[model samples]
Target: MFVTESFNRQLDDLLERICSKLQISSAQHRLAQDRYETIGNWLGARESPLAMFNPVIYPQGSLRIGTTVRPCSGQEYDLDLVCEVQLDWRQVERPVAVLDAVEQRLKKYDTYKTMLERKKRCIRVNYANEFHLDILPACPDPSSGTTCVVVPDRDVRGWKPSNPKGYAAWFESRAKTFEVYLAEHQEPLPSQEPVEMKAPLKRVVQLIKRWRDLKYADDQKIAPISIVLTTLAAEHYGGQQSTSEALAGILAGIVASIPPRNQRLLVLNPKNTKEDLSEKWDENPDAYEAFVSGIIAFHQSWQDIARGRGIPSVSATLRDLFGEDLTKSVVKEQAESIQKARSEQRLHMQKSTGILSGLTTAGSVSVRSNTFYGSQEVLP
Candidate 1:
């Protein structure tokens, strides 16, 4: 059943508050950008071999897509960056040499020396209490023009192809199409200014990621990765303007898109067919099942909130989905707002009818047989 207007308003308010809390502060953003720029400048110094290739450093994943969320407790935000150099793959016999060169140069700097560590696919630089930057050194793929690149992977000990720019572009195009559809249908577009203006899609992604974090807090290794969840949600989103509505649609749509347990789900990179986002699902069925269960639980909680149950029940459901601290804060704010409205309505009725005899002490008085004074007044 469709939710009441009052319930929808409350849900929207709670979601807006949650999204605001999930986002990193402006200072955090500036710090991360400055750090990346410093790394880029260092890598592109005239004395460095990478300078000859005219290396270009840019963000690739969540940072580029604008879906970044604040890291959970004891965890640091991850920043994925690509250091693309204009070099001929044919001339470089060993792709790992490229990664090694980048790592070597980064080690030359005293600031980066102790923070840097070699990962399977990237050079990780940890900035304690802030974020970790994963720098993937890559060379352009001649076959794919400028969109695709090949990076060295220590796990496979070979060069792997990726098109992060292309994938991001694809996602942007899908968002635009959904927004246009909403506009044509006379529904509220995600944003009138630009896709980045409202960031409904990004907010929904962040909320889902946070839910995944909470669900698998104990067994993080088995938790669904951000990329997989992001791709699925983006694939299924239909331009929901509000964060909560968009989240519900994404959760239901993604769960329905998943194949049965007997079959392995294939979440291919939209830009590169060779890269499978869900490759881990085949290797670990339990993790995949857990992800599905989490989605179901999220949907159930969403439904409970939509049912227009009393504030206490809805607050409990929200706490079950999002944690006590966030739920309590948001519910308390909503309760206060509701109480304020009732007070204003009671005062207005007292002045209008010049009768305070029937007014109840509960802030809400029955004006007639079934209607309460403040209950019917929908706040703007």
Candidate 2:
């Protein structure tokens, strides 16, 4: 009942295609980068309060990790940026003051003033349908080494520690291992440049995130956040060379990494120990249950495919897992490719045999029946 190597290849191809579709296009990537750079320049201007602190703005989340996905229907992709203000936390007692300062500077620009929205720890600037930039104001934390910084928490009315850059570095290191494996074992992706390698870990994360989006399209509030999925998947990755194997491995092991909680599960931030990625799990049990169910469903679906059981067709199962549109597209493309190969094989056999429709003609039937082991007439 085990699936054949050919089937596995087909499945991997389909999954890779789906991942490609989910990726943010290069043009969009450049646009986001340009927008952020302009904002950084404005914040680092001589007259700005942030300029005195040597503020540096950079990406920190999925965009930095190369795991960014296109936003779902009617939603904007978030570009998480850290506005690192180089100042001692002790000197600036009020952390919220830093947030206020940044907001005020942004208010100077009428356009930005209208687009800005204050969040728990960051200022969000909306770019209409393109994307939203979440700028987290952070200052150096003396206790947590150089990489750590204290970000403001309006809800707690205090400063909290975080290390977005450190976390991104750790994630990038993991991503590199997969990239090297891909370089050695596979051809470069058509969409990627020769020098630019696609990491299997990134692809795996993208796939899981896309699945989460589809599953929770209606109730996004309860769905597991990107950091949770990214962290868990990266933590559980076994350096598998293939995306399908990596995904199956992650799905199987991700649940084990979730700490058991009578009330709430705690997914600790690897860089900053104080932060919990799954903090919302405590308030919404249904969301946590949904996440658990999703992992189980994903793992079981892959297992069923591997074992050739339960599912009526791979396409149907994949459609249920991903979405109807993406699944159908991949399946159709694969079917057409298979048909072309079969047709080519038939044409090749016909040419090799020199047979065209009928073999009753003299030239077509060159080998005579009298040609035997010791016969005078040799077999043509």
Candidate 3:
């Protein structure tokens, strides 16, 4: 379903609310750790052995916690409590059964009920929603021979697993490093004292992730999102600027870019803003057109580079064409080099083909003319 303008605005508001709620300004690691510990205690009291789950039990589907280092939107302040368990769980028990167990366990917490219910379509959720916590459960595909996979909700069936251990270990280690990092940086912890990642890049990642989600939420394809992300990173961090400036600048761009369509996806205060935001639809047709057109351009540019049709330059004109994305430019340089290498290979092959063709023609002429019969200099 297409997200309406009001919903998009709501999502924007929601993002800002989350950022404000992230009380741990300095000790991000501590904030994350505290939340995990709170969740852990809740889980322990509710489901001990089952909740006592190790980060590596499944080797295939382990659990971990981390700051939203790489969110779909730049300001989408999020924390993930992910579980990567064995794929065999499906065959042994069933996906529904696993979901039921998780849902039941979550119900024990009054704070997690409402939010969990909203995610029912995505996963089995309950209620008492406060913080922005996402429970991503993943398992490997037994038949496909893949290592691990995950789906946002149990309703659909596609899984992805990137750094199983790293994800699961994030929760356990973030708190310690966050405190140390903050102390070193001379920043104050927020009143809430939330856990945060000590690494500066990780926060930047969260900002980028927020934009990614927002862009893709508008459309499933990733061209424009990739470009904008790359461009922003390059322009902000390319020279004398500090990582902090880069992060803040990117965050500003993302919040400013929220589409009007997203407004309909909002779950709160749906009635009040409907009329005013709706009129902007006709008023800002150009802006809407530009957003769509930008994505199309990004898609075409990427396709051209892939097919050896363009300059193979990623970060140069292509990024400027879209907006910004650090990933594409960094990857673009390598892609261009690879394309050049392949072109050289084709030239070498063509030269060899020409040599063979000439040899074949010369041999045929000599045979037909009967001038090669005693040519000993020709050597066999």
Candidate 4:
């Protein structure tokens, strides 16, 4: 599905086009939220055994931060949830009990019993069509202060500190620094509302994630996890007006963040300083190096897209960077959009290297095709 065959067109809108493709549609967002909410309600019901603990279910990870990428064509979208039971950490003698309890509760239901799959830290209830919920059983972390919880870690046979709420807040604070509004309406939910206009920082993380997915479609073990990428992207993101510029800056910053060969690059959770988000890197050093390589490759492909000339060449590079199907669809849509804008006499090329669709830049040139019955095309 490599698409560098024959289409001659400028690719100034490549990054913007890709951004449009990355977000979960409003309907998709609602559907995922609805499914998770149903389980959350079922778990917190008065009839449920855990009702006395004041259990609450809320989203974490990409969904929490409005950076959730639409999974590749037909891929399962993960909804990370914290099934927090209001109990002192000391109440549970063995930290594993909490996780066991959550799993046991879910298993009681015939439907959930079939869908449930126990992982090291969470119980995943996988839906058939491109969605799954990973619910981590946690208790209040009073020792660490607000919004911190201790979730059972099967690998360590103990509880690990996490602050998904705090982390989301921190991420949102960074995003809010640069206020942006889009005309398009975004789907909303109370706990973790998707962004109305995806901030440049969010877009940066999304683009990085999309690249990681495409890069590690088969080699997921080596693929950089979303948390690490999001943390680094947020830490490095300086408020840039343009999405492309923001992405470029974030990539450069991450590349710069890599440590010397002897030392591991440590990414600490912003909310819980004691918790290192990049701990997985310690388990597999090759994964860290692989992440570094992926970042470099992503940066190069992005740069190529920015400076791309012919549409076909850009399409091929995009297919290499993202996947073939997604790249093809986005490119086709962008081409149509551009064609429509041009027909309506609203198309204008940005003076500074980019020839965008429908946006009129200051000192912009009028674009037109020089076709006298199959003649050379005129430059804008």
In order, the Cα lDDT scores of the candidates are: 0.76, 0.76, 0.38, 0.77
For residues 157-257, what per-residue lDDT tens digits would candidate 3 score against the true structure? Answer: 32222333433343234224434656777677576865442333333444444434544565543323322343333323322122333344444444344
Ranking by TM-score: 4, 2, 1, 3
| Candidate 3 weakest lDDT stretch, 10 residues | 265-274
Better of 1 and 3 by TM-score: 1
Clashing residue pair totals per candidate (backbone < 3 A): 0, 0, 69, 0
User: Model 3: runs farther than 4 Å from truth?
Assistant: 1-24, 27-29, 44-76, 85-87, 118-130, 140-147, 150-153, 157-380
**Model 3, residue 231: displacement in angstroms?**
14
Tell me how candidate 2 scores on lDDT. 0.76
lDDT head-to-head 1 vs 4, winner: 4
Per-residue lDDT of candidate 2, residues 25-110 (tens digit): 88999999998888888888998877988998888999888888987788788999889898888777777999998898898977
| lDDT (C-alpha) at residue 59 in model 3 | 19
User: Could you give candidate 1's per-residue lDDT for residues 253-361 as a string of tens digits?
Assistant: 8768767768756788888777787877877989988877788778877876767545565667777777778878876675555555444453222333333322344
Candidate 4 at 193: error in angstroms?
A: 18
- lDDT per residue for candidate 4 within 299-363, as digits (tens), equals 77777765654666556877887677777778677556556666666776666654444555587
